[model samples]
Target: MTLREFMVQRQPALCERWLDLLLADYGEETAANWRRERDPFANPIGHTFTTEAPRLVEAVSGDGKFDTVAAAALEAIIKIRSVQELAPSRAIAFVYMLRDVIRGELGTELARGAHATALATVDRRIERLALLAFDVYVRCREQVFRLRQDELKRSVASLLRRWHGSELPEPASEEVVHLSPPPNHAVRR
Candidate 1:
């Protein structure tokens, strides 16, 4: 059988194994909860894994483009991981794990050497997916940091207003706030 046909035939089992591996990274209790709960609202991570893994598998076994379906699936999973306690490496590691799932499912089929080139291509595609995941993770993290920075600025502004007991003049566009040299302290430089 052709590699694509083989992958398509095994897609369901492949996806389930992939999801199991993905959930295992979450730790025992959380993984158990995710496995037991199918409600998307109550268990979004699990939902994402179930819904997206198939799309990802389909993408891999098909024409291999970062098409809308594949991109959406990758983004959904990455968005969740970016907000969690996972480090960047851990967050994106799931993409690489898919390779193992596929290989495991293929078993002796992969060893036959007939599908070697096709399997190599699939491995490359998985690598590309992981890179896309890293981009998504970084973008999400930058957004999170910007939001925290904005909130911090607002808090500081409120504190400063309270300290002065009056409205402080707003800084002009692109203005930098500078402090006077501590009221007579020598300017060393």
Candidate 2:
């Protein structure tokens, strides 16, 4: 599916899943506080780049003949992001759009020879930033999952202790189960 389609289809579900995971990791009171403090909706990814990128291109290009073309390319990148929430896939498209803008501004012969050299620094930076964002999401989700599992285990242990009229097992020693990652061999290369 196209990146835009994927974002539309998956964003809400992903957000909900992450929120649920957060609730599991932190107790209800703490999670509520986190939601208020973090305010995820205020900093959505898709809307971040649209107008700013084109403005940057225009500023750099000045009144040169290629300025309009470069601006157009940047605008295209922003448009792609405008359809849905910001995502890694949209970031990838933005990188490509910027590359095209640079090439178009430089002319065909010069663009062919210098395009990669011109964009290498920016491309690397974008990739690094995208990866860092994704890493944060993964780490947060894992923490949430662990919190939920611990809470459930504690509740179970408490009930068992009461039933048996004995001391509860230590939380750390409890047999808390979790979903396992798929085996490496089962994954498509």
Candidate 3:
């Protein structure tokens, strides 16, 4: 069979192995959701893994072109991983699992195989995906950092507004009672 035909036949198995490796990183309880539920709303992670992973494998296994959908799927998965307690390396390690899965799927065929070139092509595709994943991971972290910085800035601005408001004396009887500042008074921090 041609390499493309082989990859097509093995796509589902590849996704399954990749998902199994990925779930191994999480707690048993959390990982079980991925193995159990297939609903997108009920189990988004599982749905993404099962659905996107195969699409990604199919896309890359074709011509190794960069597909926006595949990249978005990778980004979504990475975004989820970025929030977890995993180290950055651990969070992105799932990308490398593709290599092992591919290797395992074509073991005999790859050994003294006339399709060595085709096998190398698949490996390169996985490497490209890994690089894309690293980029996604960096972006995810920067987005998280930006959000935190924005929140902090807002909180500081609010506190300053409150402190300044407190300094401006309240109007009496809820009316526009204007009063001049106390003579010779200066506010200091």
Choose the strongest candidate by TM-score. Answer: 1
Q: Once model 1 is optimally superposed onto the true structure by TM-score, how far is the C-alpha of residue 27 displaced, in angstroms?
A: 1.7
Best by lDDT: 1
Q: State which candidate, 1 or 2, has the greater lDDT.
A: 1
TM-score of each: 0.78, 0.29, 0.78
Clashing residue pairs found in predicted model 3: none
lDDT of 2 by residue, 1-189 (tens): 322233234444433443444233336875555455543455332232332443433323333223333333333333333333445454334333433444443344343454344345444443433343333334334545666767787768757777766665555324433222222311121
What lDDT does each candidate get?
0.78, 0.40, 0.73
- The per-residue C-alpha lDDT of model 3 at residue 91 equals 93
Given candidate 2, what's the lDDT at residue 8?
A: 38
lDDT by residue for model 3 (23-125), tens: 9888798888778997799888787777778877886688755566667778778888899878999999988888788778767766777688887787777
Q: After superposition, which runs of candidate 2 have C-alpha atoms over 4 Å from their true positions? A: 1-118, 156-189
> Model 1: per-residue lDDT, tens digit, 1-189?
988899999899998898888888878999889978999999888888889899998887887554766767887888888888988999889999999998899987888676998998898888777777776787678767666766566668878788766766453322322211122331111
Q: Which of the two, 2 or 3, has more lDDT?
A: 3
